[model samples]
Each structure stands twice: as C-alpha cells, then as structure tokens.
Target: MDVVVGRVAKAHGIRGELAVDVRTDSPEARFALGSVLAAKLRDGTSRDLTVAAARYHSGRLLVRFEEVLTRDVAELLRGTLLLGSTDALPPTDDPDEFYDHQLEGLAAELADGTRIGTVKEIVHGPGGELLVLVREDGSEALVPFVRQIVPTVDVAGGRVVVDPPEGLLDAD
Candidate 1:
C-alpha cells in the first residue's frame, strides 16, 4: 500500500521550491530531508523526486525537489500527489497505532464475528475519523473510528471488531 503524505500545493520561489500541504501525521518522518519520494500525476504518470530541502514556515511545509529547479517546472507539479510506499514505512513506536493505509480494506465485523463489510475509506472530519465500509448490500456504512466503537484492529487477521450503537449500521 502507498499512502499519500502530501500534495504539491503551489510553486513557492523562483529557485524551484514548492509549498506542500501535508496529509500525514508525522511530517518530519515522512518528509525527511534528502529522502526520495514518489509523485503520481492525474494523467496516470509517475515520477521520482528527491527532497532537496524541507522546512516549516509558519505552519505549512516548504519543500524543494532536486528535479524541480525553476518556477515553471515547479508549476507543472502543482497538483501532483505525493506518495510513500508502505514497504519502506517504519512501524510506529506505539503498538496500537496504525496508519490509514493499514486500516483500509480490512474486514469490519461485529463483536460476535458477524461480518458487516469491508472498510473502503477513512474520512477525516471535525469530530474525528470515520471508517467508510462498503456493505454486502452495495450500500455504505459510516462507522466512527474511535477506540470505543472500534475496539480491535487485527491487521494481521485482516479484520476490525466494531461495537457500534444500535441502529447505526441498520440506518446505513
């Protein structure tokens, strides 16, 4: 699995620098200096870029790629999606923590082992993250990704045990 770490927001300076809107929780680890990254374009094109420099200005991240040396070249990557392979991703220090990519596609089941659906996506919002499950009926169920509701995430087992309140799944 390849996770989206950031996106090229806009060209920053004439020196080929660009501003990136970070999507990962650990920017320092994901966007490490001198690290090479994979960029995916909208037209199904892929490119490898090396991080020439990375820094935080104000709140957002400012990055410079070795391949992008001019504003025009940087402008061409404005909407490019930055990706990081899970194979190279180091495990988190916290045992219970899991990345979004890891949670995706896991089977969602009730506490009694009754299967509900497969987790399709994880949506972030003001409250928190919601697990989007594609049910067998071709419908979708939004299950909150909180620890209380989702008590167990067995990544190796390829399943998540959800203890949702009554009517939440039926209503969906």
Candidate 2:
C-alpha cells in the first residue's frame, strides 16, 4: 500500500500545473520530475501517474504530470492525494523508532493498562507533533508527541502506553 505524502490543492494556472499541500519535508526528493506517483482522487479512486515537472513556488509545490496538459483538467484533480507505495520507499534504518503509519491504529493506554483512547490522528503542532486520541463520546485529546509522555508503543499488541503530563488527560 502507498503512504499518503501530499494533497493536490488546486490548479496553478492554465499550464496543467498543480499546487500541492505537502505533508513531507523532503518534497524535492519525493516529487521530483519523472517520478511515479500513485495518487488517490477526491472520490477515493486511485491512479498511477508520472511526474513530468516539479518546482517549489511561494511555499507551495507546483507539479506537472504527464498527460495533464490543461488547467481545466488540473482543476478537476484538485483535492487529490499523492502517495508512494511502501515497497518503493527506502528503509528508515532506525531502530527503536516508529513511523506515523506504525502509530495509526495503536491503542492509547496508561502505565497500568488503563485505556485512554485510540490513535486517531498524528498532527504536526507548533512545538512539535501531537497524537490525537479519540474517545467513545467522539471527543479527543491532543497528547504531546514526546518520549517521556509517550514512553512505549506496542504495534503488535495494538496499543501505546502514554505518560501524560499533569492535568493533560483531565483536560480532555
């Protein structure tokens, strides 16, 4: 399966260029020209495309895909998600570390096995990143992404043991 890296925000001009909201810091490495992309359309349909050109402009990624030569067609591709297959991805080469994909479905727990919630989202915050915990009432808690706060992650067990700061869990 391909991991999502960015979303096509809108068409740049009448040149088939698309403005992308990037989710990865290494945009140049990932969205370079001639690279292949497995994109998910707005309707949840997926397709394979080849990147013809790409450049950074005004903090947005301007990209052109092969066969997407018209602004109208590019407009229609708005809100599409660009992804890369896991098999094509280079190894992380990090031990005792986890990627966002590994953290997605892990259950949030306390030291004593007290369940807090489920990992719903991993959002990049101003200070760092935050782990969103979805509760039964549809409410959620934004747990700080820190080693001390989130000490353990058991992907096989499908849970994460968190040691939240004082009043952090109570706020939710």
**Model 2 error, position 92 (Å):** 1.8
Q: Give the whole-model CA lDDT for all candidates, comma-separated.
A: 0.87, 0.81
Cα RMSD (Å) per model? Answer: 2.9, 2.5
Please give me the total number of clashing residue pairs in predicted model 1.
0
lDDT (10s digit) by residue, model 1, range 6-108 = 9999999898998998866667877787787899986879999999899988677899988999999999998999998777777788868888888888999
Model 2 misplaced regions, further than 4 Å: 24-29
lDDT of 2: 0.81
Cα lDDT, model 1, residue 140? 96
**Candidate 1 overall lDDT versus native:** 0.87
**What is the Cα-based lDDT of residue 131 in candidate 1?**
92
